[model samples]
Target: MLSVLTLNVQAAALPRARRLLAWLDARDDNLIILTETSNGPGTAYLLEQCRAAGLDVTHTPSPDGDRGCAIVSRLPTTARPDLLAGVTLPGRAVAVTVNTESAITVLGLYVPSSDRAPAKVAKKRAFLTSVIDGLRGLTEGQRAHLIVGGDYNVISRNHRPRYPGFLSFEYEFLDALEQLDLADAHQRLHPTTQAHSWIGRGGNGYRFDYLHTGAALTPHLASCDYLHQPRDRQLSDHAAVAATLRLTVDHRTAVSAPLAEAAALS
Candidate 1:
């Protein structure tokens, strides 16, 4: 099975990064997407350690004070930065084509969060628009085998409790993805279940993270669920989401040797 996990790291510092690295070392997910990353020592350390453990890591560091995303894969992958060239914040979106039985292009995104401020709202809206344009630019074949996962910061139209303050454009982003033929993996598997990835200070819950699969790959989605251990353990404020696909990667090409070796050295 092809296992994929996505988590919002909350722009961790060096200390938290170490803890995050240790936690990641204990997991065997084939692919991991880290959101809310920064171009700082913390993200650097985490990516470096991932590489040291023989994983294929891809990240486009955000500008000095910006936040971004990263992708760490055990299966071989080729970076596809060109796919999101039109993105307003290129670093916030990282794309890669994983070399599995059927090539799957994975796009990890860290959509900008906005408040009532006009500038921030405009920025967020523009970024969301650029994201749609970027996806629209992809070829039909690419869209068929794509997986988009990230911390969207926007709840669905039917979100329970219906938190106030979200703009219409934010909701349109999800609608646009659906129009492009991508389906929410978690929602597909548990249509009646209510799960939260991030909790607000007021004790409210929000499903801010998601994994959406292309039409062709949606049928192969074996399972998709949220893992709250990370949040409960304080590794991150947001729960991690994992999805399993009925697919296989070349075992010989997958990275397990270095992780095993690192464990032995320790």
Candidate 2:
């Protein structure tokens, strides 16, 4: 089974992001995704922390700072930018392919929340389109398993009423998601989890972070949930979302199971 934990640690400063590390430390997942880390803290620090907590880690930074993304894991994975599709956006999402004996590929994506401006909004929309197109290559029960996790910065109507500018933007994002036949693991698997990642300057909080996988991934979907226990109004204001996927043991399951059953019959 391959389980992945994804979080946007706001800034990777130790004191500021210690809870983020602690939260990850508790989970024994196969993979971990951390987005929005500051360049000052660097990928080395996050990798070191993951090693201390006993996970093999690797990270790829976006050409732009703060747009950097990282992937840490107990599972053996090779990080590559070639696997990602180009959207001409400021930041980039790291595509980490876990070379399991299963031959499965899991791409981790972090889409940014462009602020309110015509240009920025247009960029966000274009980026979303590219991401969907990039991931559309996957075919069910075969090829690769695409698991995209990131701070989308769009709030869902199911969680809270639409924020002022979010009305059109959020709908567009969701529509793009549906168009690609991908499922938001949080909403589909666990709807009760609190809206996480942002406490707006306005009165309400937001659930901008997500773990989205194609319907082809349904079999491996184990469980999904959020940690909203201690709502820190000041300390970065984004809660973490975690997901567990019970992956098969590649072809070994199908091949060995039948043989084993045959042996039992004999």
Off by over 4 Å in 2: 51-54, 137-144, 157-159, 167-169, 191-197, 229-236, 248-266
Best by the TM-score measure: 1
TM-score of 1: 0.96
Cα lDDT computed for each candidate against the true fold: 0.90, 0.61
Q: Which runs of model 1 end up more than 4 angstroms from their true locations? A: 258-266
Q: RMSD (Cα, Å) of candidate 2?
A: 9.0
- Give the least accurate 10-residue stretch of model 2, judged by summed lDDT: 253-262
Instruction: Give the TM-score (vs. native) of candidate 2.
Output: 0.78
Model 2 C-alpha lDDT per residue in residues 1-266, reported as the tens digit of each score: 65766767666565555554444555555666777765665345555656554455556555566465677766556665665646455345666667675555555556667667877777777777776666555554433356777777776656665566665655677666765666788778766656555666675777777787766675678888765532453334566677877765443322112222222233
Whole-model lDDT, model 1 = 0.90
TM-scores of the candidates in the order shown: 0.96, 0.78
Highest lDDT model number: 1
